[model samples]
Target: MRRKARRRRRRRMRRRRRRRRMRRSRMRRKRRRRRMRRKRRRRRLNWRLEKRRRMRSRWQQRKMMRIMKRWRRKRRRRLRKRRRRISMMRRRGEDNEEWENEEEEEKNEEEA
Candidate 1:
């Protein structure tokens, strides 16, 4: 009888230890899942930020292109007018007429 009671006590102690180990393993698995979720959230946020930066750069590029096109057009018009005025001055041989025409062009430019 004494030997049987001792065996039963040892068996119960082993069962308790196994239960504690199982509980600890379960907690570790829960922590692993939380870490995975956090990593996924960070990746999602980084993707969004990258997308926003791309869109902003594209918008800036488009805006710069528009401004460049406007400047090119204005430059082309001024160059054409300057060429016409120089030709007219060579034909007329008068500095006053060239100056007066330049002033008139300024009025047209202001209207535009």
Candidate 2:
């Protein structure tokens, strides 16, 4: 009877050890899987962020180009108006020396 009892106790201890080891291994696997999932999620978010940044940059570039073209058109219109005014003044027999000086000034400004 004593030997039987001792054998039973040994068997129970071995079973408990096996269960504990299995639980630990399962916990380790769960932790690894969770970490992998987090990494994948972060990578996906990073890709989205980069894509948005690229789109935003492209939009800004297009906006700047549009603004610059509008400004150039306005400048051309103003220059054309100035030329019309000078031509009318010339036909009216006004002193054209002032207009010649203005043209020189405009040329210097454009060169700069």
Candidate number achieving the greatest TM-score relative to the actual structure: 2
Which pairs of residues collide in model 1?
A: none
Q: How high is each candidate's TM-score?
A: 0.42, 0.44
Q: Once model 1 is optimally superposed onto the true structure by TM-score, how far is the C-alpha of residue 62 displaced, in angstroms?
A: 14
Off by over 4 Å in 1: 48-112
> Model 1 RMSD to the real structure?
19.8
Off by over 4 Å in 2: 1-56
Clashes of each: 0, 0
lDDT of 1: 0.80
Quality of model 2 by C-alpha lDDT: 0.82
Summing lDDT over every window of 10 consecutive residues in candidate 2, give the lowest-scoring window.
Answer: 47-56
- Give the per-residue lDDT digits (tens) of candidate 2, residues 71-107: 8898778777777888888899897788878777766
Total clashes in model 1, counting residue pairs 3 or more apart in sequence or in different chains:
0
**What does candidate 1 score on TM?**
0.42
Q: Report the error of model 1 at residue 61, Å.
A: 15
Deviation from native of the Cα of residue 55 in model 1, angstroms: 16
lDDT of 2 at 63: 72
